[model samples]
Target: MRSLMLASLLTLSAAPALALAQPGKDCHLPGTEESLRCLRLAVPLDHHAPGAALSLHVTVAPALRESARRDPLFLLAGGPGEAGSDLVPLLNTTFRKVRATRDIVLIDQRGTGLSGKLDCKPGKNAETATEDELLAETRACIKGLNKRFNLYTTEQAARDIEVVRAALGYGRINVWGGSYGSRLAQAYSRLYPGSVRSLVLDGVAAPDQVVPAGAHDAQAALDALLKQCADDTVCAAAFPALRSEFDALAARLAKSPQSLTLPDPRTAETTKVEMTSMRFIGTVHNILYSQADSRRLPFLIHSAYQDRWQPFIARSNVSRDFSSEGGPAMPLHLAVVCAEDFPRLTPELLAEDTKGSFLGAPQIMRIGKMCETMSVPAVPYKEPAVIEAPVLLMSGALDPVTPPRRAEAARKYMKNAQHLIVKNGGHIVSPLGCMPRLLRTFLDQPGAPLKAECLNEIPAPTFQLNSAGPQP
Candidate 1:
C-alpha cells in the first residue's frame, strides 16, 4: 500500500548496512509509566534479501503485572508513515486493562519514525506545497530515499517482525492496529501466522481494500455522522439547516478554489490557498477518529457553510514539531494510493466516486495521475488477517479510515473472528471508554470470552459542532 517505486529502486549512497540498527536482544521496556525504552533491531532493509543485512526498530515492554501476563502485544501504527514506538505512554494508558494481562509492543515501520526514517528532514511544514509541488517533491524524495534506504514494502516489515519474536523468546504475540496500522497487522498475520496468537484491529483496513475502498468507507462514515446528528436533539436543533448549508459551502469553494485566506493555526500566517473540494474532504476527514470528535462535526460543517472560515482554518492548520518533512508528503501518498487504489479506477467509477463527495475525486485523482510517472509494482503481501486464533476486531461505526465494513469483510476470511463495532466511535476505540475493561475481560480468560456487550452499552456520538456565538 506504499507509493514510490522510483524511490524503491535507487541504491543506497554508501549508507551503512544498518542505518537505525540497534540489536533488540538486550532491549528493555520501561518499569515506570514515565520511562519508556526504544531500541533498533537489525532487520534487512530488504527482507527479500535478509542475509544482505539491514536494521529495524522494535520497542518492548515487560508486563506491568508479571503474574497475569500472557504474551507481548505488538502495536502497529497507521499511515505507513506515522511511527508507533514513541507512543508508549499513550498506549500504556489506553491498553492498561490488557497490560495487566500482557505486554504492549510498538514497531515503527520503515520510512517512518526512528526506524531508518525515509525523510530527509523532520518538522517540515505543509503550508508551502501545492498539489503540483508535492508531486514533484515526491519524485525527488523517492529518488533520495531509494539512495539512502532500501525501500522494502510491508511484506518485508512483517518478516522482520518474526526476527524480533525469535530474539525475544516469546513464541506468540498479539497484534493491535489503527488506521494504516491495520495494514501492518494484516501483513504481519500473513507473513508470520504462527507467531501471532491473537489480533485486535481497531479501524480495520482489509488487505484486499485500497484507496477507493477507503474513500467509499469514509463516505459511509459521513452518513453515519449525519444520522448521529439527526439523533442528537441538541445537534439537530442547533443546525437544522446543516445539509443545505454544506452544499452552499462546496459550491462556493468550487467556484473559487484559491480565493480563501485564513491565518494558519500553527503559525498565524495569513496565507492564500486553494480551498478545493478535496481540501474540504481532507480537512474534516480525520475527525472520525473518535466519537467525541464526531460530535463537533455539525458545527464544523455549519460554520464552514456560513463562510465562517475559522473552523476549517483551525482544523486544517497543522504542526510538524516531530514529523518527518511532513507537508503534503503527497508524493509518497500519491505513489501508494495510485498503485493500490486509484490505478485501476474506471472512468465511470472515477466520475461517480466524487459525485457524492463534497469534494470531487478529481483532486485526489490529480495526485494519483501524477504518481503514474513513478509507478512501481505493488508489494506482494497476504490478505487481511482473519485467522481463528483468539482474534478480536474493533471498529468505529464512524471510522472513516477503516470502517465497520472492513471488519465485516474480514469475518469471512477469519475462521474464528468476532467484531465489536462502537456505534459512535471513530478510529481507535479499544483503549478508550468501556473498551479497556472489556478487553481486560477477554484476555483474562481467553477461552471463557466475555460477550462484547460493553460495546453495546457505549453511547452514540454527540454531533454538535463547537460553533460558538459572538463572545458568548
Candidate 2:
C-alpha cells in the first residue's frame, strides 16, 4: 500500500513505437517475485491516423487452475499517467484469491511503463520549482516529445484498450480501475460495452468531475483529519494545541519560506530544501492518502511547530521522491489533463474550488499555464449515459481526492452497480482490510451481497503521540 502511494508520485517515460513482438513468454516484473508472461503489441499513436505506432507492454498473471474463467480481469491504473504494469505487485497481493480462477491482465497504457513512455527531464528541484520554472520545463518537455501531445487523450487510450483486448484474444474482461483510471474505465465501457464483463472502480473519478476541483475535496479531507484528532482522547491529550500549531506553522511558512539543510530521507546525505507554506501543505495532502502516514500527522505537526524540522523534512523528502520513483508520467499526465480536464476549469470555478483550501489554486494555475504551451485541443465534456454492465464502486470515506460522494455521483450513470464506502479508509480502499476478499467475491458473483460487515471491525488508526508510538 505504501508502494502504491509512493508510485503515485513517480513519473513515466516513452520511446518511439516498435514493431509488435511474438507471443508472450516467461517474464519477471520488477519489485515482485512472481513469474509472469509478457507481450508487446504495436498500437497506433493516433488511432484515427494509423501512420505511426507505439508498442504497449502487457503482462499476464495466469490463473492457478488450468480450467480458468474465459473472461480475464484487466487492471487499469490511475494518474491518467500511471503504467498499469507498475501495479503488478499490489495487484498480485490484493487479488491473490481472484487469480485462482481468472487470469489478471496488466497493460502499460500507451505512454507509460515499458510502452512508449513520455519522459520529461525534471527541473533541478521539482519540489520547490517556481510556477514560471515549472511551466518553462513543461514547454521544453512538450517541444522534445517525438509524438503529438494531443494524441494521448483518454478516448484514444480507451481505443488502445480495445486493441489490446482483441490481440489478447479475450472476448470480455472484468476491469479494476483506480483514481483517474476509474474515469478511463468509464470511457472504455462506454466505447466497448460488449467487451466488458464487469467493472470495479476504486476511488471513483466520475466522467463529469473537474480535475482542478480536487482542491475542495482535499480541504474537506484535511478538515476531517483535524476533527478526528480533536475527537480522539489520546490525540487531544497528546497534542492539545495541534490545530493552532498547524495554523501557526502554515502562517509562519507562508510569510517566510524556510531554507534548511537536512539529511535526505533516502540517502542520508546532506540536502537542502526550500520549504514554503504550499510545499508544507502539499506534503500533508500526500500524507493524508495513507492511514499510516495520517496517524503520524499530529506528531509531525507538533514537532515542526516546536522548530524541530528534521522529521518533517525527512518525511517530505520521502514523499517527494516516492512520487518521482515510479509515479506518473508527467508528459502523459499533461497530455491527458490538457486535453480532457483543463477545458472544464475556468478561473471563476478554480477560485471557488480552492477557497479556504490550504493548497490554493496554484496547481490548477500551473497546469493551466503548461496546457497553454502544449496546445492540445480540449476534448469536449459529455455527461456519460447509463452503463448496463454490473459495476462495483468502492471509495474511502476519508480519501483526500476521490471522496465517497464521487462514487455516488458515478453510481448515478450505472444501471447495475453497488457502492461500498470504507469507514476508516483513505485514498484507494480496494487493498484495505477485508477489501481484497470482498473484491474477489464481487468478481466471482457480481450480484451477490458483499459480506462487508467485517469492515466495521477495522479500527481507526491510532494517532502517534510520541516516539514510543501511540499510548497503550
Candidate 3:
C-alpha cells in the first residue's frame, strides 16, 4: 500500500508541461522575454527499464545573431547536485562573447532545480545529530526516494543531457563544466564522443580520483596562502609569525575548543557558537576555494590566535549560508559520491591517501558512514576518459579542491586537449583575471592556438593584514 502511494505521488508530481517546445524551434525562454527557449525533457526514471518518468528542465539562450552556429554550448554546474540551469544568466553574461554567435544551453541535471529534487532535510538539530541518527535519516530518505534513488548517477545524467541535445535538434554540442560539473562533462564526452564539438573543464576533478581524497591538495592550498603572506613585505611585516600563529591556533583549538558569544551580522544579536578544531579546519578549507576569501585567512588566523573569535565567527557565518532556496540536494550528493567514489575507498587506501595531511581521515569517514546503506545501480567508471574533442582544461594554481595536478592527470589521457593554469587563481579559473576573453577565444576557434599572455598579468590580490585598515 505504501509503495502504491509513493508510485502515485511520483506520477502526480511529474505534471504535464503547459507547452512543450518542439525540437529545432526558437521561442521566448519560459518566464522571461529573453530570446531563449525552455522545455521539459521526459527521461526514464531508470534508463534500462523505462517505466516511470522524471522531467529534466532544459533552457536554451539563443545567439544574438541570426547567423549562429547550430552546435550549442552546454553549461554543466558543479556540486554533483547544483542545477545547471540556475547558472544560465551568469553564463549568458560571462560567455557573452560566445552568446553573440552560439546558443547557450542549460540542463538542470536529474536531482536538482525544476526537476524532481531528492532533498533530505537537515533540521536545526542537524549539527548535533549522532552518526546513527544521520544514517537513519539517510536510510529513510533512500526508502522515500525508492527506485528514484537509482536514477541520480552522473552516468545517467550524462545520458540525460544527450537526450535533451537530440530533442533540441543539435547535432553536436560544446560543454563548459566547473568542478564536479567538469566530471559530468568528461563523462558525457566519454559516453557519447560523437556528440561533442569542444570541451571546457574548469577545476578539473578527474575520473579515478576519489572524492574528499582532496585533503592533501586542500592542505597544500592553505600552505600556499601562508607562503604568499610570507613572500609579501607588507603582509609579512604586519603578521611576522603568521605561520607559527596558525600552527599554535590549530594546536590550541585541538586541545581545548573555545566557546564564544559572537554577533550575528544578519540580526545583530549575540549567539553562542562553539569553535572546535574540526569546525575551524573545515572553515579554513572552505575559505581556500576562492582567492578573494583566502586573502583574509592570515588576518582571521592571527585574530583567532590572539583569542578574538568574533572575526572568525563573523567570516564563517558569511560562508555557511545554508539557505534552502538554492542548495545542492544533500541526498543526491551522497548518492553520486557513494555510488561512484566511495566504493573505491577502503581503510588502507584512505589511510594512505590522508597520510601527513592536516585534514586526516574524519572527513572521508563521515561520507563513508552516510553511504553504508546506499546501493549503486551501475558499475563505476574505472579509467580516464579518452576525449578527442578540442578540450581546453583550466585550473587555478591555488585551488584547494580540484588542484592543477588533477588537470595534469586528465591531460595525460586526453588526445587533443590543452591545459591552462591560472597562476595564483583559485578553484574556478575562467572568471578570474583575463581568462573570460581567453575562454571566448578558445570557444570561438577551439583548434586555434590560445593567446593566454593576459593571464600572466593577473597577480594575486594583496593579503588582508588588518581588519581595521587596508594594506600599506
Please write out the lDDT profile of model 3 over residues 233-339, one tens digit for every residue: 88898889988888887777778777777775456777666776766877788899999889998999889888887778767655342223357776787779888
TM-scores, all candidates, are 0.82, 0.91, 0.87
Residue 249 deviation, candidate 3, in Å? 2.4
Task: Report the poorest 10 consecutive residues by lDDT, candidate 1.
Answer: 1-10
lDDT sort, best first: 2, 3, 1
Query: How well is each residue in 430-452 modelled by candidate 2, as lDDT tens digits?
Result: 87788899988998888776878
> Largest lDDT belongs to which candidate?
2
Per TM-score, what order, best first? Answer: 2, 3, 1
Cα deviation of 336, candidate 2, in Å: 0.6
The lDDT of model 3 is 0.76
Whole-model lDDT, model 1: 0.61
lDDT of each: 0.61, 0.80, 0.76
Query: Which stretches in model 3 have alpha-carbon errors above 4 Å?
Result: 1-36, 125-147, 319-325, 373-378, 468-472
Candidate 1, residue 393: lDDT: 80
TM-score attained by model 2: 0.91
